[model samples]
Target: MYILGIETSCDETSIAIVKDGEEIIENLIFSQIETHKIFGGVVPEVASRLHMEVLNKIFKLAMEKSNLSLKDIDLISVTQGPGLVGALWIGITFAKTLAYALKKPLVGVNHLVGHIFANFLRKDPPNFPFISLVVSGGHTEWILVEDYDRYRLLGKTLDDAAGEAFDKVARLLGLGYPGGPAIEKAAEKGRLIFDFPKIKCERELDISFSGLKTSMLYLIKNLQKEGREIPINDLAFSFQYRVIEELLERSFIALNKFQTSTLVLAGGVVANKYLQKRFSEVSKRENIKLFMPPPILCTDNAAMIASAGYYLYNKGKVDGLDLSADPSLEIF
Candidate 1:
């Protein structure tokens, strides 16, 4: 089956064609990182406008690169929500129009679920009943995946997500935008000297990062008040360490509580080499099967959406032309 996927959930304008959810015939992505870097974050209106401008070009390129015609696509998949509302609408509208024009089956996929399914693209994908730690710029969630369509929300961030905290902290330290990569890069040359407070959630599974971000702010202010030169790399390393440690601690708790042997790391934050290395080390020590997609698949893309849509479509999950963009859509 050929599935054409559209993803404009945030700053990326992506279009992809996937075969059987496993083979990616062509995946094209146009990143707006450079455009958003000046602002130190994404502007919803700008992101939406860029998506509109480049979406058609990306779609055509995907088709051309794959050497496939519109008629060859059997299903249309799109990221429907939990993202910038304007950005979500652009992809949803384009997808709805294409599905309507082609009379193809349409599936509006949850962006987070699409992240989880990115693992399916891996040659050695994890089996059913796995624990997924989804950490990204906009979200931090723990999910229990019993099957392709069966997902239970195990826990989530109560305030700022891990990626949001990273961005906020990075900005505080004069680091550039898209904080995960920036912090990771700075952390490479530093040591974990600063002792940032760790996060403690009221609920066992729920997590919070607002407190951690606040702590970092206070620390920086105190250092500045003392007329001391801030150790940017050390601060970055310490902050990243605390953040990754919290995630790892929670993931271990979830694995034990749910009795799941396999652990899947999803979303853009998983692209951080430090996080990946730590998770690899711990998962091996604890004898847990860990699965993570490559950096290309970790970020917002259409291939994962297409891969997810293939399974959702087969399970009789289809949407009508009236499908609307849901910015706050949740994966269940």
Candidate 2:
């Protein structure tokens, strides 16, 4: 079956076509990083407008690249929730129009779960009952995946998501928008000199970053007041270290506690080199198989949605024309 997936969950406008969900025929993404960079964050209205402008163009390109026409598409899948409602509206509306005209099944995919399923596209797939760490701009979660469409949420962020903290901190430091890459780059030149607090939560799997973000703010302000030249790179390095430290600690604890042998990493933060390197180290020492998609699949894209669509469809999941966008949809 050929599934055409459209994703406008955030600042990215993407479209992709996949064959049976595993083989990506063609995936295309139009990034709004430059536009949002000026603002140092995403503006919902701007994102929705950009989606409207480029959605059709990319949709055409994806089809042309795949050498397939609308008639060849067997199913239409779209990210329906857990994103900007305006952005989600654009993709779901487009998918709905296509489904109506083509008389095909439309599947609504959970954006977060779609990340976990991205692993299926990789050659070295992990076995069932694996531990998945999905850290993103709006979400940070450690979930236990027992099988297809079966997710047991083990833990999640108590406050701001990891990606959100990165952006907020980067902005505070003038590191730039899309904080993950900016901070990561700056962190290279510096060392983890600052002793950022490592917060602990009552729940073993639960993690908190709100305090961490606040601590960085206090440190930066105090250094400025004291006339100490802020070591920007060093601060970035230390902050990144603290965030990743919390993530690894919680994830490793979960893995051992659950007795899961496979570790799967997903979401946009998975692209961070430092985090990935650290995860690689732990996976090696623990002798657990780890599945991480290439950067292309790591971030939000239509291919992952298509992969998820295929699985959701098989699970007898189908959306009606009445299906609408949901910004805060949860994965059950």
Candidate 3:
């Protein structure tokens, strides 16, 4: 079966054609990085407007690249929630119209679920009953995947997500947008000298990064007061170190508690090479299978939406004409 997916959950306007949720025929993503970089972050109004402008062209391109006509698609899926509402409405509206016109089933997918399924985009996919960590710009979560559509929420962030923390800290250091990559680059030239707080909560599963972000801010201010030049690289390294250490610590705990044999990492934060290396070492020593998508798939994309959609489609899940965007949509 062929699945057509559209994702405009945030700054990225993407579409994809997946065959049986296993093969990606074509995945087209139009990232607004350059446009949003100057602003140091994504502007919802600008993002929605940009999506309105380029969506149709992107649709045509996705169809053209996939070499498949609308009629050839068996179903249509669009990310419908847990994102900027305005940005999501554009894709949801377009997808609803397209599905109606094509006379195909339409499914609205949860954005976080889409991230977890991104693992399927890989060649050697991990088996079920795996520990899934989805750390992104907007969210940080741990899920126990029992099957394609069955999941159990293990833990999630209590405040800012890992990726969001990265961006905020990067901005404080005068780094550009997309903080994860910029911070990683700076850390490479420096060493972790400062000790940032390690997040801990009574509920071992819950995570926090807001305190870590504040610590960095205060650290910089104190340096300025001392008439000392702030070491941007060292600060970046220390900041990234604390963030990754928290993630690793929590992840290991979850793995042991859940008794899962595979660890599946998803979301934009996985793009950090340092994080990957740490996970790689753990995977080898702990003898746990590590499933991480290529960097391209690690970030937002429609293929992951399509992959998750395929599972929902099989479960007889369908949305009606009244379907609308749900920005606070929760994934269990």
Candidate 4:
């Protein structure tokens, strides 16, 4: 079965064609990062309008690239929640209208669940009954994946997400928007000198980055007070190191407790080279199989949504015309 997927849950407007959930025939993404960089964050209204303007073009491109028309698509799937309400609505409505018009099945998928499916796109997909760490600009969560459509949320951030913290710190440093790549590029040339805080939060699965972000801010301001300008690379390095350390530490705890051999990562923050390196080292040491999607799949995209939706569709889970976006959609 061929599934046409649409994703506009945030700044990215993407479309993909997936055959039987595993094969990606065509995946196209239109990013508004450059446009929203000036603001150092995404403006929900701007993102929604951009989706309206570009979704059609992206749809056309996906069809052309896949060499398939609407008639060839067997189902339509779209991200329906856990994102900007306006942006989610655009994709949901577009997909619903198309599905209704074509009289085809429509499936609404959770954005974070889509992120988890990103693992399957990897060369070696991890099996179920494993732990997944989903860290991104908007969310930070540890999930126990028992099987397809079965997610047990172990814990999550109480304040700022890891990626959001990175963006905030990067903006304060005049690094750029989409802070992950910006800080990563700068960190490559420098070493960690500043002693950043890594909040463990009592050895539980829960983690916190709010304190870490504040610590970075104060350290930078204090350096400036001493009439000193810290090298951007060193600052970036310190920030990345502290964040990766906390993430890996908590993930390892989960791995040991769950007795799972697989450690998987998903979401935009998974693109961090430092995080990837740390996860690789720890997984190797613990002899746990690690699965991480390539950078392209790490960020938001329709391919992951389609891949996840394929499983749901096969299970007879389809959305009706009355389906609406759930901004705080919970994964079960």
Candidate 5:
């Protein structure tokens, strides 16, 4: 079955066609990073407008690249929630129109769950009953995946998400927007000198980054007050270290608590080289199999959404035209 996936949950306007939820016939992503770079973060209004403008073009490109027509599409899948409402609405509306015109089935997928399912696109995907760490700009969550469409929320960020913290700290350091890559690049040339406080959550599986971000804020202010040169590289290294440490610490705790041997890393933050390297080393040491999607699928894309929609559709999940975008939709 060929599934047409539309994703406009945020700044990215993506359209993809996936075959049987595993093979990607065509995946097209139009990123708004350059447009939002000057703003230091995504502006929802601008993101929505960009999605509306580029979605059609992206869809056409996907079709051309895949050499497939609308009639070849068997299902329509879209990211329904847990994103900017206006942005989500664009994809939802476009998907509804296609479903109506093509007379195909439509399914709304949770953005977070779609991230997890991105692993299925891999040649050797992780099996069921695994633990997933989903870290993105808008969310930080640890989920226990019992099976496709069955997820148990183990823990999540009580404050700012890891990606959000990265962005704020990057801005604080006068780095460019989309802080992850900027900080990652800067940290490579520096050492981890600053000893940022480690977050201690009430729950063993839970994660917190608010205090860590505050600590960085004060450290920078103190340096400015003393007229000391702010070591941007060292600060970025230390900050990235502390954040990834907290994430791995909680991940280990969850692995031990659940006794799950398979671990899946998903979301935009998974693109961090440090996080990937550390997780790879630790998972090996602990004898836990780790699965992560390629960098292209790491960020927002329609392929994951289509893969998720395929499974959901096979399980008899379908939506009507009344289906609306839920910005706060939860994965159950």
Candidate 6:
């Protein structure tokens, strides 16, 4: 069966066609990073307006690029939550209308679960009974995935997500928006000289980045008071080192506690070179397998939504006209 998936949970407006749940026929994403950069970050209202303007064109492009027509699609899958309400409504309403017009099955997917299924796009997909880490712009979470659609939440960030921390630190250093890539580039030219204190909570797998972010800001402000101009590159490296170290430390602990044989990382933060390297090194030391999806899949994509939708579709789980965007949708 073929599924056409739509994703507009945030700043990206995406569309994709998946065949039989395994093959991605075409995945098209139009990013608003450049547009939002001037505003320092994504403005919810602007994002919603942009989605309203481009979603229809994107849908057409997705189908054309895949060399298929809407009539060839068997089902429609769309993300319906945990994002800006306006942005979510655009995609949700569009998908619902398309599904109704085509008389196809409509599956509303959770944005977080879409990130987890990103692993399926990898060459060596992580098996069941593995530890899943989803670190992104708005969220940081650890989940135990025993099967498709079956999950147990282990821990999550109580404050700002790792990606949010990255962006805020980058902004402080005069770096551009979409801060992860900019920070990674700067870190390459510098060394981690300053050691930032890591946050340790009573919970084993839980994480907190807000404290780290605050600490860095305070340190930088103090340095300025001393009439010292900080090296942006060194600061970037120091920040990344602490962030990645925390992620590695918590992941290792969870792997041992869960006795899982593999580790799977998803969400946009997975694209950070520092986290990727740290995760690989830590996983190797523990003799646990690691699976990371390609960079494209790491960010929001309809292909992952379609992949997740396949599991639900097969189980005869479909939504009716009552389906609407749930801004607080929980991941199952």
lDDT of model number 2: 0.91
Deviating ranges (above 4 Å) for candidate 2: none
Position 319, candidate 4: lDDT: 89
Residue 296 in candidate 1, Cα distance off native in Å? 0.6
TM-score of 1: 0.98
**How well does each candidate superpose onto the true structure, as a TM-score?**
0.98, 0.97, 0.97, 0.97, 0.98, 0.97
Candidate 6, lDDT over the whole model: 0.88
Error of 4 at 264 (Å): 1.2
Which of the predicted structures, 3 or 5, would earn the higher lDDT when compared with the native?
5
TM-score of the candidate numbered 3?
A: 0.97
lDDT tens digits, residues 199-264, model 1? 777888898988888888888899999999999999999999998998999899999999999999
User: lDDT tens string, model 5, 129-178?
Assistant: 99999999988999999988799999999988889989989988988778
Where model 4 places Cα greater than 4 Å from the true spot, the runs are 122-124
Candidate 2 structure quality by residue, lDDT tens digits, 1-332: 99998999999899989888788898898999899888778899999999999999999888888888889999999999899999999999999999999999999999998888788875556788999999989889999998878899999998889999999899889888888999999999999798887688999889888888888889989999999998999999999999998898888888899998888899999999999999899889989888888888989899999989998899889999999999999887
By lDDT, the better pick of 3 and 4 is: 3
Candidate 1 local distance difference test against the native: 0.92
For model 4, how many clashes?
A: 0
- State in Å the error of residue 247, model 6: 0.7
Higher lDDT: candidate 2 or 4? Answer: 2
> Each candidate's root-mean-square deviation in Å?
0.9, 1.1, 1.2, 1.3, 0.9, 1.2
Q: Can you write out model 3's per-residue Cα lDDT over 1-332, one digit (the tens) per residue? A: 99988999999999899988879998899999899988888999999999999989988998887778779999899999899999999999998999888899999999988988898875678898899999999999988989877889989999899999999999999887889999999999989799887887768989988888889999999999999999999999999988888888888888999888899999999999999999999889999899888888899999999988998889888998888999999877
